[model samples]
Target: MGLHPIHTSKSYHDKDELGPEGNEFTSREEVFDYDFYKKLASDPKVLAIGECGLDYYRLEPETAAKQKESFIAQIELALELGKPLMLHIRNAYGEALEILRARPGARGDVHFFAGTWDEAREFLDLGFTLSFTGVITFARDYDEIIRNTPLDMILSETDCPYVAPAPFRGKRNEPSYVSEVVKKIAEIKNLDFEICRTALLQNALSFANIH
Candidate 1:
């Protein structure tokens, strides 16, 4: 159980939780809360700037603009802080990539990627790592992408409390289940489990800039 927790923030709701009492909270300000995140990112243990990015899976048109505005702010903060980002892109991969492309030099991972190969390649070309969740265990759609991605550009996650891997499917997920994700990667890449394991650990450390 030797695991380093990477801190992450989202550019979205729960105004009551983070908002000042009785003041009207705007999505842009609340989502990007520069001062709040700057404080957190200053912590030595805090490794990244987000789980913040675009999520258009069920977005309303009005809120979409705010979401993009918030995302850009976080991206700017990531660049300013020199910390990597932990992106959460859902159905808006195209827009997300466009924004990230415009803002060069901010390193990040596209957590729980479920995009097409072309989109994946775009991110790879832009120097971002792609992380897979336990969904790969029960679904074959990601198998090709997993096999095609280079070892250095790949990482695994549990997305825990959701999407538990096979043999543990339909149950609550935990960090320990990430081994199944690594196992799937080994099978897809046709590499020995230990080698794949070592390489993935190295890739993760490198991506997060951990020594």
Candidate 2:
């Protein structure tokens, strides 16, 4: 299995101690350092350079700009190393898409995507895959986005230790929970569970560049 890094400024220590609010503990210094990623990229198990992207929800303008810079730097690294990217965009899809369209040799998924149909189409047009998480299973509003998105452009992730599906709502998520996402997509698109699972497995493999 290919392993992808979920880049964030929050320290794992802080996450372990404080939870999501612990994200507030993240320092600007920790967020902008490319040298850290250089060391991480050297690891053989690290397949991609991200879950890095902009988060306008909590960051100040300057901090958000720094996040964008770090994201671009990672994009460059992915280009140089010929690896795919794993993006985490929240409330900054426009900015993320702008940067992505401007850069060449950058490829990856926009994980846990919560954008509109037009926005989704834009990303698809730019050749990026859109990954859905367990949110789609419960969020009534996401039905249209789930239904409209083509199967080829669809990918599923648990975003584990995070967004868990129904019946397990408000619980810590794990990679095994990816099955829930698969089931939801199958229901939304009126597809067979096995077919959806196989197709998504293929999509995930292709996006990660695994032969």
Best candidate (score: lDDT) = 1
Q: Model 1, stretches more than 4 Å misplaced? A: 1-29
Residue pairs with clashing backbones, model 2:
161-173
Backbone clashes (count) for model 1: 0
User: lDDT per residue, candidate 2, 1-211, as tens digits?
Assistant: 1212223444223555324423434432455456666777867677777778876665554566567777888888888777778887878889989999999668888888988888888888888889998888888777788788889889998877776787688677778988999999999999999999999999988987788
**Model 1 quality (TM-score):** 0.85
- lDDT of each model, Cα atoms only? 0.78, 0.76
Count steric clashes of candidate 2. 1
- Backbone clashes under 3 angstroms, per model: 0, 1
Q: Model 2, which residues run further than 4 Å from truth?
A: 1-28, 31-36, 42-44
Give the TM-scores of the predictions, in the order they appear. Answer: 0.85, 0.84
Provide the lowest-lDDT 10-residue window in model 2.
1-10
